[model samples]
Target: MTRSPATPLPPPKARRRLRETAALTQTQLATRVGVTPGIVRAWESGRTTPRGRKREAYARLLKTLAEEEAARQAKQKQQEQQEQQEQQEHQKPDEKQESAPAPVPKLEPESKPEPQSDAKPAPEPEPEPRPESAPVALTPAQAFDALYAFSAPALVRQTFLLTGRREQARESVERAFQAAWERWPEVARDRDPVGWVRATAYEYALSPWQRFRPRHRHPEPPPADPGDRTLLNTLLRLPPRHRRTLVLYDGVGLDLPETAAETEASTPATANRLLHAREAVAGRLPALADPQVLHRRLTELASNERLRAAEPPAVRRGGERRARLRTRAAIAFTVALIGTTALTARTAPTHYEPPVSPGQAVRGVPHRVAPGALSDEELELRQKLRDQMQDGPERLLPRLE
Candidate 1:
């Protein structure tokens, strides 16, 4: 009997992408392939490969998923093209109407010319200026700079409202922009780039570890105005999450859903936080019970503080510097690790050597003892031998035949 050849599979990354695109879980894929989820995970992570029947099943499944994803993308593209065509079709009449000239007023033959006014006619009004053309597309760096310029100052102010510390706020904004610069492509393509930076800044400003920072351990000076000071103090008193929600919703004028989304909280949770924050503020100052009034006060409080962000170019340079430093540090660490591993491999013993056992006392062997006194019989025999030896010399004459 002959066996059929195994199907070819995509790369690990593509395999994972195919599964995600199909909305299939690792466990589900594992079950279909008759393997454990762990094995499937290992396969997707490029740690292991499947073989025999499982390999063929996984390959076939991925191929189908890829086809489906491609088809979906094609359909979406076609729909977008159709929509664009429809929009152009709708715009044609408006363009024609705008381009057409007005009919000239017809003059009757019986009409008589009215007498000219003696006074100078009113000066003709200047025609309104035409709208400017659409702007040219910006390069990535230019776009990043524009976004930073437009949002940084306002974001610093908003972050100040959240943290009530001008320096911390500035630092947070700088860090967020640095991160955005590091991921400029992603941020630029995001639907709301401002929101992305805002969220990052908020997260940095509200991080619990900030308290451990030596610079942040001390409190910053309050705003100059008593009202501003009081408002700032009240805002600082709220929990970080609530404070963030309040600032996003009231200070920045974001809508409830947007605030919730930015804060990563449910709408109801965000509303509750906002309500609690407002109640706390109003309790401290009776005048801020109204949302509009609270918003105005928050804005006024933030604006009253003097906070500045680093220049965009400086921020971008800083981000790049940080990235290079991190990369270098990682390389150093990896080199050290590899060196240590190689050293160990070179110096390690090749064969096992059994350990030597410790010495133990023998069971039956008698220990040596010092001789004390010779017995009397042994002493007498020694004396007799001394006397007999002297006589044995006379008796030692040669014996004749």
Candidate 2:
């Protein structure tokens, strides 16, 4: 049988006590009690209290904390007054001592008139000061929306640069947003929430997704080539180290020193990796001769990957098969055309086969020799090319064949 979800237990007195003892605000107290502040007000008003044995605990806890806070405030106020009074007394004594001699004692005193009045007794002394806590504030909805917009994209970019993984960047942004929701006041106080999120996202990117996963993979920065659709593809193929180096150097457009700091590598190592990375790219790179083109390509790769994540392993394998088929088809077509052309060139007949002289006549056609064919050089030229024919299927093979 399916178990019905248990009815949530009403807030007990003990929870209220915890809130009271913590001296938390309604919202803060509600958070600790796991109930809304409205519920707290209901309990305090005696309209409803937690039921069962837990009720006793809540009542005792809240009552004790309330009493304690009352006593604490009373004590503190009393102390302040006492200190002020004492200071006055001391000052008065000093002034009197400096101006005149000792106090004069009265020789005789007579009662004048009795005044009727009711005077209250002095209040008790206050307790010691409670440690001060930082103030907590709630964020406005508009503030939260602005924060999310600023932080999300910045985090997304940082995560990409740090882990060379877009998915991780997305997850990092989500986690940061959740964190911001819980402690929005703190986020609001930051000078640059976007920068904070970006930094946090990069830290998140460095963490392993799962304990069992490899730790060796480090993310690279994006490339600079704007027109290059295959920029991301090149990154996907690079070793993790090279990827990280390239990403810091190119994706973020960091200088060598900054790249080294970002990657936690020495400047020399960073410089070396960058050098090799450029060389590697240049070796296979075409369309990358211009710096503008390279920048466009890199930008395109980062933007595209940010939009399209990698396929699942199974789907990727299927795609690989299709790619292989296309490659093979292209190779076979190229080879067939080359071999057929060679055979045709060897078998074709030429007009100069009988070594026709300039202004000579053939059986049915007038022959015009090429310019340098006459002289003793004719024999040399004949040997050099006795037969060469115009291009056509007819020259390729005899009609009988």
Model 1, stretches more than 4 Å misplaced? 1-134, 357-401
Residue lDDT tens for model 2, 52-121: 5445455555666667777988999999999999998887744433456779898887878775578667
Residue 203, candidate 1: Cα error in Å is 0.5
The positional error of residue 57 in candidate 2, measured at the CA in angstroms, is 48
lDDT of 1: 0.83
Q: Which stretches of candidate 2 lie over 4 Å from their true place?
A: 1-144, 154-166, 176-193, 206-229, 289-292, 305-401
Instruction: Report the lDDT tens digits of candidate 1 across residue range 202-223.
Output: 8898999988999866777778
State every prediction's TM-score relative to the real structure: 0.60, 0.32
Instruction: Report lDDT per candidate.
Output: 0.83, 0.57
Candidate 2 has its poorest 10 consecutive residues by lDDT at: 307-316
